[model samples]
Target: MKILSDTIKNIALEIRTGKTPPTSNHEYFGEEINWYTPSDLDKGKFLGKSRRGITGKAISDKKAIVFKPNTVLIGAIGDIGKLGVTSDFSSSNQQITGIYPDPKKVDSQFLYYWLKAHKQSLLDKSKSAIVPILNNKDLGQVKILFPEYISDQLLIANLLSKAENLIAQRNDSIRLLDEFLKSTFLEVFGDPEKNPKNLPFTTLEKLCSVIVDCPHSTPVKSKEATNYPCIRTSELTNGYISWDSMQYLDEDEYKKRTQRLIPEAGDIVYGREGTYGEAIRIPKTHKFSLGQRTMLFRPDYKKTNSIFLWAMVRSEFVYRQAKKKNSGSTVGHVNVKDIKQFRIYNPPIELQTQFAQIVEKTEVLKTQYQQSLQELENLYGSLSQRAFRGELIKY
Candidate 1:
């Protein structure tokens, strides 16, 4: 094993920090190359697609620098420690530093996993400023221990790659289930935006018995387990609450806070600020209090199904509405008024119930996929920890 500084070759740092020439400058989409940034890197995976592209002119003018395939890209600014490997000739913005590993001394994938394993340490090296930034010089000094033989590095890379692939496949299964539900929604309800089904359009306030946001102030948190879990916007994910991450409040405090709008099993919780437009249904009755920047909506069972309402609010139609109504300079948020006023296509109660039933069935499959994904993630973490520590070879 040796320090990463000794195993790596040249570390190329890009300094160009302007927007690539727009689509107007390119003859066609083919003339543009994939331009990656810190956002494009999905932690350990290299997302080859780019939201923005660099035109041929930008590349020709030296406004963007292209790195060859297998070059490990690390985020140098804003988002620190994001890692990825270029699959093809790709250019990154100024915020990234590319590391080209020595083929004889180290494998690229091994280097990637090493960096990922030490992501937090690299992040800590960043200057504590308004926005943390990592310099190439500082990153170059970071230490990584690896085997002397490239074969060892290859072996470790292969093991970690297999773990990553399993995690990805599990994620794909979950995504496909979500897609199936969305496709079914569209097939049955028609596009909410187009209203092809000619369903009656009405404001959310019309379909629900209650539409109210939580108190705008933070509740006093308690360390004791006797307290009720407080559901915050950050805990909302995949149309459900992340119970493990919820904060806690004293029983009395929780009772006082939620006295006006306590969340029930049939109610839908909507995140209003920071991470707006995400809605999750309370799957079961629980002693919980609503945190700030979130609202509660209890659908009238006769008018709408809880699952249908959840899907509707989580749909693209509602997302567009929320985006349009969002107001804030730094962090956008939708007001309770905006949420109440947002239109939804009201279909027959029986039809909405049918969608809910389908969702219930798909949720069972999603739960299985989620459990497997979590297990794979845990296994990957364990393998990663052991592999870098030189303990994986024993297995």
Candidate 2:
């Protein structure tokens, strides 16, 4: 193990800040140069391209400095400890610091991985201020356990790279499945915005039997298992209730919290605040209480299919309405009144049922892909821990 200061050749900070920002359409104005910021860096990977580019005029005017390829970048402001390696000639905004490794002393890929592994530790050292910051000096003080030989470093990097690739592949499969579902929805119902099929339009209130709000106040949570699970906005994801991170509520608390309504298998739960408009259909009959900042909708089965309603609310048309109705300085929210007023395009019941069947089939495949992805992620975590602790070499 060696202090980073001793092993690295140089640490360079990006000089451009608020004073000299490239024009928004720099490509049309001047010579194009790739410019990166904290947002441009993907966690634990190299940035081959950047979304925004700065003009060469900025460089010629002494406003920016371009770092050569293989330079390791670390975010010093906003999103701290985001790491990325650069390809070809590139420059970053003032918020990132570039680390150039000494070829004779350390391999660039090895440094990248080491920094990725210790990102949290680096963030921990950040000064507590209005905005968290990790300066060049703090970055230089980081301590890493480096192998004596470059070959050893390459071996560790290669193993971790393979793990990342597998995880990425699994994620790609999941994304493709989601895209398929979206395409199918468009093909069946047409765009909800345009109503190109001239489907009957109705207010969301008319299609549902009941719309109940979550308890205004937060309920007391318990770590121990209870008869009821409390569903919060955070637990709503991918149009389903995630019980993996749910909190518990005892009988008495559950009864009081759910006095307004108890969700049934076909009901839809909508997030009203923060992550607004995330709607999930209740998959089965379950004893659960709603946490704050959420709404429960029980669709009239004869009028609409539960899954179809879920898809409609989750669609861009409804999302835009939710966003427009949302208010609040710190935390935006859509009240029950606005939610009830949301307009929904109603297709035939038979078509809605068919769409539900298609969704169910797609979800089954998605679940399998998600499970595989989680397993790969776990494997990557295990390998990373072992590789850093000098345990992988023995095996």
Candidate 3:
């Protein structure tokens, strides 16, 4: 494979950063032009409409830079590797580094994919500060390895774009499954907020065999991967535990941490501090101890199942109730006392168990979809790597 490489500065016509208009002046902000920040960069191929915009006054006042169409935007601040290409004449805040790629030297879409594939390399060059940041100089110095021919660049970009589209389709499938389960939950058990069925209400405390808080202390995480995972609030997403992202601890630390209650299958882990009230049931195959700001709920089979309790805590009604208890705090949080009093619509045990079974089956399907999505992601990564290396093309 014959590949050519050059610093981003050498390939681009210009490298520039943006600025925010003075907040004291209200006239400087409006919908006159699209303005982006780090959060707006969602790894999308093109940067279009943004969450906020700046008026012409801001641009006229030299507070922002207008990046032309096909200009690549890389996150230059705390989020170092977020990549996107400008779809129109757009402006952004200081967090974005705008690159106008020299059309003769590199294809815009190819540059986007190449940067996407090597985002970690950009991260490596970032200055390790409290919040990691990449400077324009460092960004301009990023080495882009590419085919000398623009036709090959376009071909490689198109191939990788197809792979990305497949990966995206797989993600959409997984998300649709989640939406299906959520709707099904509401169908089986009427909206918790509405309580249209007027089902009998019960406190979570009564429905559970055990409601215990995680140890207040932080676990000393193992530098190397270990079997003993310490589950944190970050790992709780979409009613599932992201086992892969969990921090691990030594066996001794794990034992010490689980001294209060070792989380097992059928137990619900609830986040209490940061993202208060998000909950997920512990899977049957995994064993782990709770991290900070989390509590465990063990459903009493006689009253409710783990699925019911987990869903209830995540429901709009219970979440609103939980928020009410924490309304006074500067940082939102739920305490054991408040959690114990949370009222929920409690249907008959037979009905709860039926719903539990339905959820269990749906989860199994979701797991399969997730596995497929992982494989697609792996394929996309491999394709991106090879496509940029000149291995996917023939002269």
The whole-model lDDT of each prediction reads 0.80, 0.79, 0.85
| lDDT tens digits, residue span 1-395, model 3 | 46898999899998999888889899888998989998889757887688998888888888778998998898988878788898889988888888898999998998888888889889988999998888988888888898888888898888888888888888888898888877877988899777887899989899989999999887999998788878789988888888677899989998999887888888998988878878888876655889988998998888887788888889888889988888445667887898998997789878888888888898789888888888988898888777876677765
Q: Which structure among the candidates has the greatest TM-score?
A: 3
Give each model a TM-score. Answer: 0.84, 0.87, 0.95
TM-score of 1: 0.84
Tens-digit lDDT string for candidate 2 (70-108): 888878887887888877777877888788776666677
Candidates' RMSD to native? 3.9, 3.6, 1.8
Tens-digit lDDT track of model 1 for 66-128 = 777788888878888788887888787778878877677677788888888889878877888
What lDDT score is found at residue 26 in candidate 1?
56
Flag regions of model 3 displaced more than 4 Å.
327-330
Local lDDT at 102 for model 2: 65
Ranking by lDDT: 3, 1, 2
Better of 1 and 2 by lDDT: 1
TM-score of candidate 3 against the unseen true structure: 0.95
